[model samples]
Target: MELNSDQIKEILPHRYPFLLVDRITACEPGKYADGRKCVSVNEMQFCGHFPQQAVMPGVLVLEALAQTGAVALLTEEENKGKLVFFGGVKQARFRKQIVPGDVIELHTEIIARKGPVGFGKATATVDGKIAVSAELSFAIAEPESRN
Candidate 1:
C-alpha cells in the first residue's frame, strides 16, 4: 500500500517542519514500510546546520526512520489511532552525509513485539547508498487528552 503526505499525517501526529517523511512508497501495516524524505535547502535545519554547506542533520534522518517504523506498527487494526514513542535506538551508524536535493529512502521492518512494545530494524538511503542504519525500539501508547 502507498500513502501520501496527508494520509501519513492521519497516522502520525507530526506536522509542518517536523513532519519529515514526505511520502510512503510501500507499507505492510504491521510488517514494514518504505518512505521518502525530500531534503531541501529551504528546510529550517539547513538554515543553521551550515549556511555555507547545508547538510541534513543526522538526528532528523533517524527520526525519519522512526516515523517509517511507526507507520508500519500504527497501521495495524489494533494500533490505529495510537501513538508510538521511541523507547531506544541501538547500533546506529551514519555512513554518508545527506544534503539538499537528496531524496532519503527510509525503510523499517518490525522485527519483534511483546504487547505494546516492539523493535524495528531501520535504514535510510540516498542515491542507493546507505546514509544511516539503526535498530529502533518503540512503545505504543494512548494519545494524551488535548483538554
Candidate 2:
C-alpha cells in the first residue's frame, strides 16, 4: 500500500526536522517498505554541516534507512503503537553524496526477526544510484508515556 506523509506519521514516531521519510511508496507489513525523502537546502543540517558545500550526513542517511525499516515493523498487528529503536548498524557503506534537490529512494526489507529484535537490509538511492546501504538492527519496545 502507499502512504502519504500524514499516514506515515501515524506509523512513525518522528516529527518535523527529524521525520526523513517524506512518503512511503510501498509497504508490506512485517516484510518491507519503500519510501522517499526530498532533500532541501534549508534543512538544519546544511546550516552547520557545510555552509559552502552542503551535503547530507551519512549518519542521517542511516537513520532514514532505519526509519524506513521501522515502518515495516510497526505496521504489523503485533507491533502497532510500539517504538523501534536502533540496536546497531552493520556493513554500512556510503556510495555517493546526497545533495539538495535530490530525492532519495529508501528501501528496507526485514530479513530476520527474533522476539522484539529485527534485522533489515536497507539502501538509499538517488537517481538510481546508491547513496548509502547498510544492514540495520532494531529493538521494538513500548513508547514511554509523556506524562
lDDT against the true structure, per candidate, is 0.95, 0.95
List model 2 lDDT by residue over 2-30, tens digit each: 99999999999899899999999999999
lDDT of 1: 0.95
| Clashes (N, CA, C under 3 Å) per candidate | 0, 0
lDDT of 2 at 27: 94
Q: Give, for candidate 1, the lowest lDDT window spanning 10 residues.
A: 39-48
| Reference-based lDDT, residue 63, model 1 | 93
TM-score of each: 0.98, 0.98
For residues 25-92, write the lDDT of model 1, one tens digit per residue: 99999999999999998899988999999989999999999999999999999999999998899999
